[model samples]
Each structure stands twice: as C-alpha cells, then as structure tokens.
Target: MILADTSVWIDHMRRREPELVRQLQTGNVVMHPMVLGELACGNISNRSEHLRDWGLLPRVEEAAHEEVLSLIESRQFMGRGMGFVDMHLLCAAIGHGVQLWTRDVQLRAASVECGVSFTETA
Candidate 1:
C-alpha cells in the first residue's frame, strides 16, 4: 500500500501522471483524511468527480491524530516546513507500514528523518 501525499494527488490531477495512474488502476494507492480534505478544499473544477474517484480508494485505517500532536510537540520537525497535515500523513504511513509517495521536498525530508519508507516516483 502507498499513502500518497496531497502534492502527489494534486500533481496527478493536473498531469494524469502515467505511473500514478497505473498505481491507481491497480488499487495500490491508499487515502488519508487530511489529504482528502486538502484536495477537497482545492480549486479543482470537477471537484465532485475527483472526490468520487478518490473516494473509491481505500482509506488508512489507523487514526494518526494523536501521533500528529506528538510529532508537533516533539519539535523534531520544527523549522523544517513540516505542517500538521504532513506529520499526520507521515504517521499514517508509519502506522500502516506503507510507502509514502510524495513530491514535497519537506515531506520527503521528514519521512527520512522519521525513518518511514517513502518514494518520490509517481
């Protein structure tokens, strides 16, 4: 399973990246609430259609809310441009033991720092 960050989803929506599309087709991608919320709040013209498509994907079962607070309290990611949503996504990936696919440099760095598996490709 792969937890794709908001950046990746946004890029995929705009570009229809081949690899990402392939992953989605194969049902290898999983969704996080925060990522979904971010995308929902974006300026996508076909928002309902996009949400419906994403809604078909499985959602991460573990709740990362507390972990997100802990991560913020730890201050480890401080000044690294890591936000609550980023940490939440990282926690979801870590908890699920899934690869985090993202294009955000800061999120990639945080994943490395936290020793979570990640992929920048698609």
Candidate 2:
C-alpha cells in the first residue's frame, strides 16, 4: 500500500500527469488527514468531488502532536525544511508501515535520514 502525499494529489487534480492518475486508480493508495486538509485548501473548482473520492479510501490516523514535534526537531537538526503537516504525514506513513509517495526532494531525503519509508514513483 502507498501513502499518498499532497504533491501527488495536486498533480492528479490538475490531470497534468497521466502516470500519477494511473497510480491513483490502480495502486493500493491510502490517505492521511494532513493530505486531506491540504487538498481542501486547493484552488480547484471540483473540491467536493475530490474530497468524496478521497473519503472512499481507507485513511491512516494522524500521529500524536508530540511525536510530530519530535520529528520536526530531528529534521531541523538535519537542516531539512520539513513542516508540521509534512512531518505529521511522515509519521503516519512510518507508523503504518507504508511508503509515502511524494515528489518533494527535501522530503524524500529527510525520509531516508529519519528511516521513514517513502517513494517517488508515478
């Protein structure tokens, strides 16, 4: 199973990348709360439809705030610009033993440093 990141969702919403859309349709994709929140904040017109599609999938519960803050501190020490929501998504992915799919370079690098499994696959 794959834990989808906001980047993939954004790309899918735009219909700019066929591979990403294919993955979403064929892969065992799961959503985290932070991803849903980010999607809700998008400037797209069919926001409700996106949410409905996301809701149909299984969701991974968010990590504890303290755990996310700890991860944030660790990433900061590593000189990574990981944000709270990003860290939360990472923590959820790790806790659930799923590979997070993200296109962000820094996030993928920090995921390696933190031993948080991730993927950059289309």
Candidate 3:
C-alpha cells in the first residue's frame, strides 16, 4: 500500500505521466483527506468533479498532531514552521506505514524523520 500525494494527482490531471494511475491499477493506493482538500481547494468545481469522476477516494488516517509538532521541535525546517497540509500527509504516511509518492521537495527531504519513503517520477 502507498499513500499517494496531491502532487501525483496534479500530474495525473495534467496528463503528465500516469504513474499513480498505473500504480492504482495494480496496487493499493491511498490519499489522505488533507491531500484531497488541498487538491480541491483552489480549482474550479469542474476540476473537483473530474477528480471524482476519476474515482478519487478519500483516504482515512489517524491525525497525529503532536508527532509532527515534535518533529518541528527536533529538526529546524530552516527556521520556518512546516505547512499543515504537508505535516498531515507526513503523519498519515507514517501511520499507514506506506511510502509516499510525491513531487513535494519538503516531504522528500523529510522522508527519513517522517518514516515515509518518497519516490519521484522520472
């Protein structure tokens, strides 16, 4: 199982490479609720509709706020607080024990601490 990130969905929508789509076809793929919201927040309604049409299912993960917060305390993220959405995704990936496939640089950089393996498209 893998926690697919919003960046992958954006790639799919843009017809970038279909990596996630291909993975979904053969393996278990999940998306965190925050990921869904992030993807759906800025776009037009039609975009959300298209996502639904594409069978985007909401992924449920135990929200662990403290663990993420502790990570911030432990490691300075260049003296800036981590974004909430990114933090949630990290927590979800850790809780689920799944690798996170994303194009997000911060998430990739923090993969070891977050316990979420990250992969990028070639």
Mind giving the per-residue lDDT tens digits that candidate 3 earns over 1-122? 77777777777767745667667777668767777777767574477576684455546575778876765666665354458677767767776688877777677777665667756455
Positional deviation of residue 84's Cα in model 2 after best superposition, in angstroms: 0.5
Give all TM-scores, in the order shown. Answer: 0.86, 0.82, 0.76
lDDT of 1: 0.80
Q: Write the per-residue lDDT of candidate 1 for residues 23-81, one digit (tens) a residue.
A: 78898899988888899988997888989988889999655577778776784776788
Global lDDT of each candidate: 0.80, 0.76, 0.68
Give the winner by lDDT.
Answer: 1
Consecutive 10-residue window with the lowest summed lDDT within model 2:
113-122
RMSD for each model, in Å, please?
2.0, 2.3, 2.9
Which of the two, 2 or 3, has more lDDT? 2
- Pairs with backbone N, CA or C atoms under 3 Å apart (clashes), candidate 3: none
Best by TM-score: 1
Candidates ranked by lDDT, best first? Answer: 1, 2, 3
Clashing residue pairs found in predicted model 1:
none
